[model samples]
Target: MSAFRARPPAIPTTLVDDAVTRIIRWDFEPGADTGVHTHGLGYVVVPMTDCHFLIEEGDSAREAFVAQGAAYRREAGATHNVVNAGSEPMSFIEIEYKQAL
Candidate 1:
């Protein structure tokens, strides 16, 4: 009786039950920052809103303009600091794989 039907599910990357996949939502006000940290596993990010990002690696830092609904992937073990450089609140969804040590 519905006008629209649901879509099928997408293929998963891993099959292990213990392999952790999580979605994290970040909200940053203007001039807010996330301190330097190292990622334990690979991650994919999708920005929910437009943002100006300042990513710092070691002593060097780069500025990027991230548009809404943009997807990006990153390698594991990467370290960086993130800063919000826009006038509005910046938000993004982060999906990271979990691995046991």
Candidate 2:
């Protein structure tokens, strides 16, 4: 956990969890956030709708714009907080690989 205290948790629903991978769907209303945390497994994210994000990493902050269906991957051990910066709701699917990819 980092020093960021941004609140109103984003909703995450596990879609699949197995020996090979773990999948989840995350939904966020405007201003909702995924609190600062570390990822133990490498994962890919596919945006379900166009997304506008405010990303906070330790002492830094940034913006991200991802189109719907655009998928991206991140390495394990990354720690950050993601906030829905757009006025509209947004959602994405997260697929975490159990085995290194």
Tens-digit lDDT string for candidate 2 (1-101): 57665567899999999888999999999999988789999999999999999999999999999999989998899899899999999999999999754
Clash pairs for candidate 1: none
For model 1, what is the error of residue 26's alpha carbon versus the real structure, in angstroms, after optimal superposition?
Answer: 0.6
Q: Listing every candidate in turn, what is its Cα RMSD in Å to the true structure after a full C-alpha superposition? A: 14.0, 2.6
For residues 1-101, what per-residue lDDT tens digits would candidate 1 score against the true structure? 56342322111233233545766677777777666679887888888899799887998999999899889999988898788777777878778777534
lDDT of 1: 0.74
Residue 29 error, candidate 1, Å: 0.4
Angstrom error of the Cα, residue 94, model 1: value is: 0.4
| Number of clashing residue pairs, candidate 2 | 0
> TM-scores across all candidates?
0.75, 0.90
Cα-based lDDT at residue 59, candidate 1 = 89
